[model samples]
Target: MNWRRLWAVMLKEVRQLRRDRITLAMIIGIPVLQLVLFGYAINLNLRGLDAAIADQAGSAGSRALVMDMLATDVIVPVREARTPQELMALLKRGEISVGIAIPADFERRRIDGRAVAQVLVDGTDTVVQSAALQLAQVPLDTTPSANAGPLRDAGLSAAQRISVVSFYNPERRSAVNIVPGLIGIILTMTMVMFTSVAIVRERERGNMELLIATPLSRSELMVGKVLPYALIGLVQTTLVLLLGIWLFQVPIRGSLLDVYLASILLIVANLTMGLLISTKARSQFQSMQMTFFVFLPSILLSGFMFPFAGMPKIVQWLAELLPLTHFLRLIRGVMLRGAGLFELWPEVLALVVFTVAMMALAILRFRKRLD
Candidate 1:
C-alpha cells in the first residue's frame, strides 16, 4: 500500500464523517445515552416493591409482623385483600409483586411457638423475586409477638416463622423469565430495523417518487408495504417461541391463541414505529441511527435486560412509553403466569394506542415529504 495514497483516502473519509452531522451526533450521543441508562436508570438493588396483605388473624402479633415487613422499606404494601383468592388475583393482574397472608390461627400458633405466615411472591422476575425473598426473610428473624410488647408480657413465646412460596416460575429459573421476554425484544429489533430502511431505500433509489406519482393513495401504499412484513413478523414470532420451548424448555402456560393475538398487536406497533423512522430519515445511515436510538431504549427500559421496578420512578414512567415494555409484560404474563386477555388488557390497549399513533405520524410525515 502506498502511504501517501492511504493518507489521502483517510483524510477524505474524515472530511465526509465531519460533514455527516447525524452520524457524528450518534457517535457522541449513543455513548452518553448508554451511560445515562446504565449508570442512572439501571438498578439491581430491588426496593419499594408493590405488596398486598391479607391479614386474617386481626391480632396484635399479626399487625406487628405487617409493620415489621413494611419497616424494612423493601416491600411496600399497597393494597389489602380479604382472602387468598383476592391476593392471587392481584398477582395475576401484575398489580402487586409480593403478597403476605396471615392465617386466622396465626396468633394461636405463635403462642404455641410454631407461628407460620405465608408470603407469596411473583417469581416471573427473578431479580425482583430474589430481592423480595431476602427482604421477606428479615421479618422472620425477629419475633413479631415480642415486638408487640403485650404478647411478650403475656408469657407467650416470641417466635414467628414465614413460608415463602413463588408463583409462575416456582423454581426461579432465569430461562423461564428471560426466554419469553426475548420474543418481544427480537421482534422489536428486527421489525424496527427492517421497516426503518424500507421506504428510505425506495426513496434513495428514486422508486418512492414513481410510486407517489401513481394513483395509489399514501395509506394504501403504506398498508401494502407493511402487510407482508407483518406476516413475516408472525413467522419470526412463531420461530422464536418454538426455539424458546425447545432449547430453553420454557413452558407456555397460557393459551397459544392469546400469545399469537398479542404478538400480532406488538408486531404491528413496531412496524409502524419503523415506518415512522423511515419517513423521518433521509438516508439508510440516518435510518439505522434512528433505529438504534429506539432500539437501545427498547432493550434497556423495556425490562428485557433489567428489572422494570428496580428503575427509578421517572425511568419507569418513560418505560411506559415504549411498546416493547408493554409487550414484554404481556408476553411474560401469558407465557409464565397463564394470564389471559382480562389480565393483560391494559398492555394490549397500550399496544393498540401505540400502533395508531405511530401510523398516524408516519402517514403525516410521508405526506409532508411528498409535498
Candidate 2:
C-alpha cells in the first residue's frame, strides 16, 4: 500500500454509492428498520392471552379464582363456557389460548380441603404455553390466608391446587405447530421469489421495451405474468399440505375447503407484492434483494416461529401488516382450531386489502416507469 491510492479508491466508491440512490437508501434504511424490529418489537413476556371459563361450580370460590387469574393480567377471560366440552371446543378452535374448568364439586372440595381446578392450555406455542401455565398457577397458589374474601370463606388452604391440562400437542411437539405454519412460509418464500424476478428478467433481456410498445394494458400484462405463478402457488400448497400430513402427521382438523380458500388469498397477496417489487427494481439482482428484504420480516415477525402475543405492541402492528402473519394465523386456525369463515373473515379481508393495494401500487409504478 499506497495510502493516497487507497484514499482515492475509497472516495470513488463513496461517490458511486451516492449516485445509486436506491441502494444507498436501502443500506441506511434496512439497518435502522432491523434494529427497531429486533430491539423494540420482539418480546417474550406473555400477557393478555385469551381465556375461556367454564364455571360449573358457580360458587364464590370458583368466581374468586377467576377474578384472581384475571388480576394477574396473564390471561383474560374472553368467553364463558357452560360445560367442559364447550371449553375444550373453544381451545381446539384456537378461539381461546387458555381454558379454566371449575368442577361442579369445586366449592365442596375446597371446603373439604381437597379443592382442585383444571386449567386447559393450548400447547402448540410452547413459549405461550409455558407462560400461561405459570400464570394459571397464580390463583391456585394463593393460600387461604392470602385470599381475603370468598376464597378464604371456602376454607381453602395451600393444598388447594389447579391442575393444568395441555391440549393440542400436549407434549408440546414443535412439529404440530410448525408444520401447519410451514405451509404458509413455504408458499411465501417460493411465490414471492418466483414472481419477483419476472418483470425484471424481462427488462434485463430487453423484452420489456418490445412489450411496452405493444397495445397491452398494464393490468393485462401484470395479470398475464402473475396468473401462472398463482397456479404454481396452488399446486405447491397442495403438495406441501400432503407432505406435512404424511411426513409430520400434522392433522387437518378443519375443512380442507377453508384452508384452500385462505391459501389462495395468501398466494395472491404475495404474488402481488412480488409484482410491486419488480416494478421498483431495475434489475433481477435488485428484485431478489428486495424479495429477501420482504422475506426476512415475513419469517421472523409473522409469529410462525415465535408467539404473536410475545411481540411488543408496535411489532405486533407491523406483523399485522405482513400477509404471512395473517396467513399463518389462518392456516393454524383452520388446521388446528377448525376455525370457520366466521372466525377467519378478518384475516381473509386483510389479505384481500393487501392484494388489492399491492396490485394497485405495482400498476401505478409500472405505468410511471413506462412514461
Candidate 3:
C-alpha cells in the first residue's frame, strides 16, 4: 500500500462529504439531536400525571385525603367525578391517569380495615402503574396517628386504607401495552418507506418525463400515489393485530370497529407523510434518511416505548406534533381500555389535522417539471 495514495483518497472523500450539504448536516445534526433528546427530553421518573378525584362522600375527610395525595405530586388533579363508575369511565377513555374514588361510606369502611377509599389505576402503562402505585403505600401508620385534621376526626384509620385497583392490564403485562403500539409502529415504518421512494424511483427510472406528459392534476397524482399504500397499511395493520392476539394473547376489550377506525386514520396520515417526504427528496437514499430523521423522534417522544407523562412539558408539546403519539393513544384506548371512537375524539382530531396538512403540503410541493 502506498501511504501517499491512501492519504490522497481520504482527503478526496472528506472534500466530497463537505460538498453534500444535506449529508454534512445529518452527520453533525443526528448526534447532537440524539444527545439533547436522551439527555434532557426523556425522563423515567414520572410527575404531574393527569388524575381525577371521585369524592362520593364530599366530606372534609375526603377532601383532606385528596389534598394529602395531591401533596405527594405522584399525580395531578384534572377532573372530578361524581361516582367511582364515572372515574373509571374517564380512565377507560384515556382521559386521566389516576382515579381516586372516596366512597360515600368513607369513615365507616375503615372501621373493619380492608379498603377505605378505592384508587383505580390504568395499568395499561407499566410506567404509570409503577408511579401511581405509590398511593397504595402511603404510610398506613399515619392514618392511626393523633393528627387533629378533620379526616382523622372522622375516625378513618386502618391498616389498609387505599385499595389500589389496577385496571385494564391488571397483571401489568408489557405485551398488552406493546402489541397495540406495534400496529402504529409497523404502519409508520412500512408505509413511509414504500412511498418515500415512490417519486425518487420514478425519476431514477426515467419515468419523470412520462409522468410530466400525462394530464393528471397534482392532487389526483398525489392521491393516486398514496391511496394504494393506504390499503397496504390497513393490511399490515390486520396482520400485526392478528399476530399480536394469537401469539401474545393481548386482549381487545374495545370494539374492533374503533380499532379499525384508528388504524385507517393513522394509515392515511403516514401515507401522506411519505408523499410529502417523497416530494422533497431528490433520491431514494435521501428520502429514507429523512424518514429516519422523522422516525427516531416518533418512537422516543411518541410514548410508544416510554411514558408520555415522563417527558418534559416542551418535549410533550413536540410529541403532540407527531401523528404516532396520537395514534398510540387512540389504538391503546380502544384495545386496552374498551374505549370507543367518540371517547377518544382529541386524538382523532389531531390525526385528521395531521393528514390534511401533510396531503396539502405534498400536493403543493409536487411539480410536474423535473428539477
Candidate 4:
C-alpha cells in the first residue's frame, strides 16, 4: 500500500457504500431497532400482570385485600371469579397471568392473624412469579379487621400470609421454562435463514431462467420452495423435543400432536416470511440482513428472553405481530401447562392468519420475469 493509492481506494469504497441504499439503511436501522427494543421494550421489573379476582369472602375486608394488591401495581384485575374453580379454568386457558382466590373465611383468617388470601400465579415466566411474591408482601392499610392491619408478610413466609402458589412450575426450574421457548427460537432462526436467501441464491447461481421457464405457477413454485424446508423444520423440532426430554427432563404434558401442529404452523409462517424477504432482496447478503430485521424482535419481544407481561402496552402490541410470540405461548402452554389447542385457540388462530398472510405476500411479490 502506497498512501495515495490506498486513499483513492478508500474513497471509492465509500462512494460505493453511499450508492447501496439498502445496506446503508440497514446499518442505520439495525442499531436503532436494537436500542429501542432493549432500552424501551425489554423490561424485567414486571408490573400490571393480568389477575382474576375470586372474592368469595364478599366482605369489606376481603375487598380491601384486593384493593391493596392493586395499589402495589403488581397486578391488574382482568376478570371476576365467583369461585376458585372458575379462576382455575381461566389459568388453564392461559387467559390470565395470575388468580386471586379469597376464601369465605378471609375476614376471619385476617382477624386470627393468618394468611387471608391464596394467590395463584402462572409460573412459566419467573419474572412474573417474582412479582407475585413481591405482591404477597404488600401491606393492606384499609383492612376492616384491626388485627390484619398490623401484618404485612401475608401468606408466604411470616406475617403477610399470602399463600403464593406457582402453578405449572411448582419447582421453578429454569430449564422447564427455557426448553420450550428455545424450540421456537431455534425454528425461527433456522427456517427463516434457510429460505431467506432461496430465491436470491437461485438468482446468483444463474438458475432464475430455469425457474421462469418452468410451467409451475407462482403459488406452486413458492410452496414447493418452502415444503422441503418445512420438513427440515419439523425434524429440528423433534430433535430438540427429544433432547430436552432426555437431558433437561422437560415433559410434554399435552398431546404430542398439539406440539407438532403449533410447530408446523410456526415453521410455515417463518418460511414464508423468509420467502417474502427473498422476493424483495436483490442478493443473498441483503436477504440475510433482512432476516435479522425480523429475528431481532422475535428474540427480544416474543417472551423468549424477557417477560412478555413486563413490556409496555405498545411494545407488547408490537411483539404480538411476530409469529414467534404466538408460537412461544402455544408451545409453552402445551408442554408446561398441559393446555390443549382449544384452550390456546387465540394463539393458534393468530398463527394461522400469519402463515396465510406471509404466504400470500410472498406469492404476490414473486415475479417470473427477471428485471
Worst 10-residue lDDT window for candidate 2 reads 141-150
What is the per-residue lDDT of model 1 for residues 235-305, given as tens digits with 9 covering 90 to 100? Answer: 99899899998998999989999999988998899999999999888899899999999999989999888
lDDT of 4 by residue, 1-371 (tens): 69999999999999988988789989899889989888998888888899899998888878877888899898898887889899988888888999999899977676566777888988888777888887778675434454444543343342357788998888888999999999899999999999999999989999999989999899999999999998999999999999999999998889999999999999999999999999999988888888888998899999999999889899999989999999999999999889999999999999999989998999999999888
lDDT values for all models: 0.84, 0.81, 0.86, 0.88
Return the top candidate by lDDT: 4
Question: How much lDDT does candidate 4 score?
Answer: 0.88
Error of 4 at 228 (Å): 0.4
Write down the worst ten-residue block by lDDT for model 1: 151-160
Better of 1 and 4 by lDDT: 4
Per-residue C-alpha lDDT of model 3 across residues 119-238, encoded as one tens digit per residue:
789999999989987787665433532433323433343325787789998888899999999999998888888889998899999998999999999998889998888888888889
User: RMSD of model 4, in Å?
Assistant: 2.6
The TM-scores of all predictions, comma-separated, are 0.91, 0.86, 0.93, 0.95
**Can you give the lDDT of residue 247 in candidate 3?**
97
**lDDT, candidate 2, at 185:** 90
What range of 10 consecutive residues in model 4 has the weakest lDDT sum?
A: 151-160
Q: How many collisions per candidate?
A: 0, 0, 0, 8
